[model samples]
Target: MGSPKRGHHHDLYQIEASLKEILSLLSEVEIDHKVLFLNADAGFDSENLRQMLEKEKIISNIKTNLRNNKTAKNYYYFDEELYKRRFNIEKANAWLDSFKALFIR
Candidate 1:
């Protein structure tokens, strides 16, 4: 979900705004199963985001830069198989395009 922050004020991540959005999105998600993990790509690798997700009891499996395995304070276990899944955004988008309901909105 990384994007050039579309608002006039520019930053890679406005920490406060990102926090609010995380909380809001968490609230909206109704978990039917035990939600043990939240996987994100290296772009989302951040200590702040990891800590927040920790507090909420979700395992933050954010991929790190090849040299930054220690940045997130050793709290997460990097699953290579899961991290590899983030590389196929185009396939996921194509799958979504196959669903007619996604075009309705």
Candidate 2:
């Protein structure tokens, strides 16, 4: 994680580097199966990131965040049912937030 700074840090800012790190760790762990999907929020929606995930054979289930360009949504595929499952991840994060001392440096 990056240092706590004065302003907000967008998730997409370091996504490529972070994804590389995660892929390396996954390789080390030897998961024995392919990573099929990457369920993320709108903050992670980007053409570059989608291409990277596609290269790894992982389908991105990120929400549409057009940011003013509505036509961009047509280029991506979003699964509403799969996206709903993302709430579980949020719940886990919320639980972790209760232990902020361990996570927030």
Candidate 3:
């Protein structure tokens, strides 16, 4: 429910670490579940992270830039209709940001 922290505008490694941490927490909680839907900005795209998720047999539905080289020959199974519906979550964030009090100076 929280976004990964970005310090000095360099957050690639931090985002990866946060994802790993979240996975570990989920495992510790003993939540037996399949199909993890992860939505992330393009910066979170990394081969190592993707391979880790694959090794763990966790399906990830992440948003990424089509032009990124990391997508080369990598087959991701996702429902386009479902993804379109999920776009509302992003829109909600934009709507919330309209209230300047939500921002911390």
Candidate 4:
């Protein structure tokens, strides 16, 4: 019920917070990979986000929409295996939403 007010958010503001959260989680773990691949859904996809990823030298695996890409050449290179996991997570959230008893509010 606590959604952001309509015009207060843009893609970068939303994504920057998500990125920081991911980084905080990663800080508590030990991983082998030097090059990290960040997979974000279409909503988080923007030119600013792309530039941020490129400048950090992180692999950008973002889903695209009509507004983001005019041609195939401009699209982000997505990893099929990892990208598939994104949808799985979304599906899990959808399934969880069916339980009315869990939401106290």
TM-scores for candidates 1 onward, in order: 0.57, 0.77, 0.58, 0.55
Candidate 2, position 70, lDDT? 78
Off by over 4 Å in 3: 1-6, 91-105
Candidate 1 structure quality by residue, lDDT tens digits, 51-100 = 76677677777777555664545655888897677668667887887886
User: Per-residue alpha-carbon lDDT of model 3 for 1-105, expressed as tens digits?
Assistant: 335564676446565566667777787889643566655555656667677777667665655657676546766665566667667988998799787665765
Candidate 4's error at 62, in angstroms?
1.0
**Candidate 2 ranges with C-alpha deviation above 4 Å:** 1-7, 97-105
Q: What TM-score does prediction 1 earn?
A: 0.57
**Model 1: residues >4 Å from true position, as ranges?**
1-12, 15-29, 32-34, 66-75, 88-90, 94-105
**Could you give candidate 4's per-residue lDDT for residues 1-105 as a string of tens digits?**
212445766556666556656565666675422378777777777877788667656788888866756775565577778988988888897898877658865
Best by lDDT: 2
lDDT of 2 by residue, 25-99 (tens): 777888522567889988887888988998888878998887834776456778999999899988998898889
Scanning candidate 2 in windows of ten residues, the lowest lDDT window is 1-10
lDDT at position 28, candidate 3: 84
Q: Candidate 4: minimum summed lDDT over ten consecutive residues — where? A: 1-10
